[model samples]
Target: MTDQFLHDLLGRMTTDEKVAQLMQLATPFFKGASNSGEITGPMVNMNVTDETVENTGSVLGAWGAKEIKAIQERHLQENRLGIPLLMMADVIHGYRTIFPVPLAIGSSWDLELAEKSAQIAAKEAAVSGIHVTFAPMVDLVRDPRWGRVMESTGEDPYLNGAFARVQVEGFQGDDLKNNTDTLASCVKHFAAYGAAEGGRDYNTVNMSERDLREYYLPAYKAALEAGSEMVMTAFNTVDGIPATGNKTLMRDLLREEWGFDGVLISDWGAVKELIPHGVAANEKEAAEKAIKAGLDIEMMTTTYASHLKELIEEEKVDASLLDEAVLRVLELKQKLGLFENPYRGADEEREKEVIRCDEHRQTAQDLAAKSAVLLKNDNVLPLKKEQKIALIGPFAEGNDILGPWSFLGSTDDAITVKAGIEQKLNKEVIAAKGSDIETGEDDDLQKAIKLAGEAEVVVLALGEASEMSGEAGSRTNIQLPAPQLKLVEEIVKIGKPTVAVLFNGRPLDLHGVIDKTDAVLEAWFPGTEGGAAIADLLYGEVNPSGKLTMSFPDNVGQVPVYYNHFNTGRPKGAPDAQIRYVSQYLDSPNAPMFPFGYGLSYTTYAYDQFSLSRETLKKGETLTAQVNVSNTGKVAGEEIVQLYIQDKVGEIVRPLKELKGFEKIHLEPGETKTVQFTITEEQLRYHHADLSYTSDPGEFVVFVGPNSAEVEAQSFELE
Candidate 1:
């Protein structure tokens, strides 16, 4: 049946019946539908019961194969037109085989691997009958102060674009109709949500047209170009207009200019927020504005479903806009093959067979180990077999490995640090709670010290839970919550060789740990098999090669910092009489605790040299930039060969450096390998003021290294 069958059925229905299709209600994720207006309050309560999917208009963030299938079955069987509601979930990293966050994966600089992870997520999500995912958040994030930087691929347009294409392929695959397990990837917060004012969530985004076109639009374009079936408008505004209802943004840029023939879904309740932004008088007016602006779906907002039909019939809004919106929605269902095979994705056996399998666990472990950026390390790491280690912290024994938006994962099965260490060690290992997470009590500190006294080394496991740093989970001061810092400081006074293993979703201030601990490993809320992976790296089973995707600032005030920043005339370097007038801060060093692409390995590696195939090349000529990386350590390890490019004299001023390519290579002790990266004219262009992309004749520098901080530079010229 084409949408004509559904459309004709809808046509025969009463006004209330058509309105029901537009209405989207938020029900309890575990239960069904509810009359709850807003569930997220200060208490952080969740109202769940045994309710059917038909009571609510649509399901929001519901996972688990059994629950998801039941909801779908109910929607199809119970609804008046037998219309199946769209199932949405936040499959941010991985559905079951959890990979590192977008930022960490981006640090791998391996877009192929990133895409593969998404493919796995899509396969698992589709098994559960999920229609779409609010993912591949292609926000060009430059400010690390924003906790959600962990979710973005970092702050470069060209780099983000390349990664976006890979993610789209992973999510949508080649054929959506044939591949029901694959769902639509929603490239989110449509535009300029990353450049939030003051690094606050949902803050106003004020930027010039040139800035928006040049820096922010490329990744979203890349996703659409790669055949992303749908788009989710962002939560913030652009130039005083809310992105959910901005005609210039949604109509002009997304639909008309880009020729996107997909449905535009609004961020959660974003349509209803137009009133708060003073853009509309009420939800009714907001619906009128959003529908005209090209928003087809109103996620979690009742504005569209409740009022849009009334507005259309009364001539308050054109019925053609409604028709156009429904057409786009129907067309998407046709593309999904949902009309012909609505139950194609709802296979019970596939759901049980595919999710959280051994392959998924192994992949998760590999990604977790690879994402572990060795911030600071001494010989204390890769602990010897003879050593008796003390693992102490709130997170060590707890199975909280699943990060934010991981609704599908069960923490009950997550690997604990204690379990991981015991499996690898025959030596006596002492474990203690040490203290509470944020408030290290004096008695708890004494207990940690006592445990440290009995062990040869102390491995302090600390950091936030998965839910502490995601959306609406932002903190004012992103530091190691509470007494974990105090506990570590007291234990370090015992003078035992100490290593801090941090499990966090976002970067945290580790100044105290840096000052005290001999070694530190940022094991970002490594999902599910995190403990097993951490133990491998700790016991020398695997060498740490992961690099920092986001910078770790010394303090909250020193945030919005990154490695590829441009040089200012009065930067912190110059000796000045009055420092007050400069950009330098008085209280803290104007630098991050760890720079972007900053990581250390168990073994030492040296950069031999950088060489280019050609000094000058024609417009269409391909250039090869090569470098020799030698492992100069006793143990074998992996090295991430980073390649950065800079156009010295372009039509516009460029950043000091832009990451062009990277290769993660495995090398045995004393091994050397030559790595090469190819460059084209496309790699040498920037968006001009007139919104045109063109490459200029100029000198381009190719900097290669393990991370951004350390690199060997070579130059090439385009003729």
Candidate 2:
């Protein structure tokens, strides 16, 4: 549809209808219709009337084809303009067939798998009556203490931006108007939501504009460039002002500077919460400020619906802004083909077949295996299927493996570690529960130890419960629970080889488990097929290849350790440097437990130190760096060869090394593969003190190796 068509439709709407278009209510608001035509229950508390409900443009968190179709049918019958309701839901990793959390997917570093996961999620959601997904949360999180890090790809801006583009492409696809399996993607938590104070959820975020543009803003921009149709305001503030009402963030930067003309919505009552943030006195002021700040939709709040009319009537806000906001919503619906077919892809029959199908489960399993990071190994892995095994811990048979934001995913249907291992082997493996995620009696611990002693090997399934690390799940103490640690201590005393399979949402302090266990697999709450994936890794069916995206702290004291950090003037030269006056810790090491892009496979690879194509690169020319990587171990394996760069001198300080490029390649034993990378001038750009993104003419260092710490460097210059 053309712009004129949307304007014509908008011109026909009354003030109340136009205001209602900016208001998004939950599914229950429409369902709680009173016989006498008066709003009651939750809708009543929302300050909305039956008339307002009738004019509302969209529904939030609606599910099921039958229920959604019923609501839409009744809504179209009563609505005067015959505008269809847009259905939106939180379909993050997967809808019904759950995949590993976004952080795990980032560890895989496979763009094809990331896009495929989003495609499958969109397909399941579309069939189940969802028109839009509030997903692809691309915030770059450096602190594991920030619980929503599970929803993020990792801490690097370039990697996060790459995933953002591919995931957005997967969600919207090329033909959204005709493709029934696609969904309009809403890139969320705009500005700096991840840098919440104290690593707490919905806390205040304060950062310089230079830092925001240099680090936090790239992923959101990438998503917009990839065609994400909507943006969700974060629950936190940007520069001391709530994002929902901050004109500079929503208007001047997002609109005028970035050229984002898409619809902008709040993150669930964020408009009303501006009052609590002390930015507004009431919902009326919040409504006035939100619209003026260029927010198009107010989600699950009475601010827009209850107060927009008065704001427009009193001339507090321009009536033209209301029309433009309503027009944007109409344009989205038209692009979705909802103006013609209100029930765009809601089909109950297809929903049954596609929601949790075998094909989707298989893909999830494959990706889950790909996402499992091997944190520690002493050749104790790849257990024989016939070996007597004791599977012990809270998650041995528990199925709470699906991480947060998997609202549509079923926990009962999730496969447990014991179940997955049993499905593969002919004989049943004995299992015991040593401890719960938090606590257990000594008797249970003794029973588990005895079982481990009787078996030829022990596979300890440990880590946090699902609720421990997303959204409001921040933690100051990131180590495993004491009970689980005790279970490890007792089992390791049995003299049997132990392989710890950890299920978690964020990077953890693993001193207790890592030191005692013979091997450790960081199996982060691997979703529906998590158990199966771990079983595959343990039984040699698949080789573990995942690397860490976020750095695991040596302890909670080093809360926000990441590879891409600036060098201090008094930097500690080595892990055990004796320069007492330098920046050395009195009690702990400065390095993380595991560095970014660090993972161990059953096989090893040897790299011939990289060589540069040219000693100096001109502005318009590209420089290529190549290295020969050979598989040194007996078995074939996959390796993510990482390429990082260092700007020796900058107008502003730069990270010690920044990840610029990576290639995941598979090699057979003794097989050599030549991996090459090209460096462009754009890749060198960084925000200056004035926020101008340009590279200085100076010396640079190129680092190529397996991980951040174990790298070999070569010097180059940009002319």
Per-residue lDDT of candidate 2, residues 1-719 (tens digit) = 67787778888989999998888988777853222234455556776787988999898888888778888889999999899999999999999999999999999999999899999999999988889999899999988888999999999999999999999999999988899899999998898899998889999898999999999999999999999999999999998899999999999999999998889999987999999999999889999999999999999888888788898889999998898888888989998999889998999998899988999999999999999999999989889877889999999998999998787888998989999999889568778889989989988888898898889999999999988999899999889999999899889998999999999999999988999999999999899999889999999889889999999999888877889988887789856556786776789999998999999999999999579999998888999989999999998899999999999999999999999999999999999999999998888989998888899888999999999889888888998
Query: Any residue pairs clashing in model 2, and if so which?
Result: none
Model 2: weakest 10-residue lDDT segment is 31-40
Q: For candidate 2, give the lDDT of residue 376.
A: 91
In order of appearance, the predictions have TM-scores of: 0.91, 0.98
Model 2 TM: 0.98
Q: Model 2, residue 451: what's the lDDT?
A: 91
Local accuracy by lDDT, each model: 0.78, 0.91
lDDT of 2: 0.91
Q: Which stretches of candidate 2 lie over 4 Å from their true place?
A: 32-44, 574-578
C-alpha positional error of residue 264 in candidate 1 after TM-score superposition, expressed in Å = 1.0
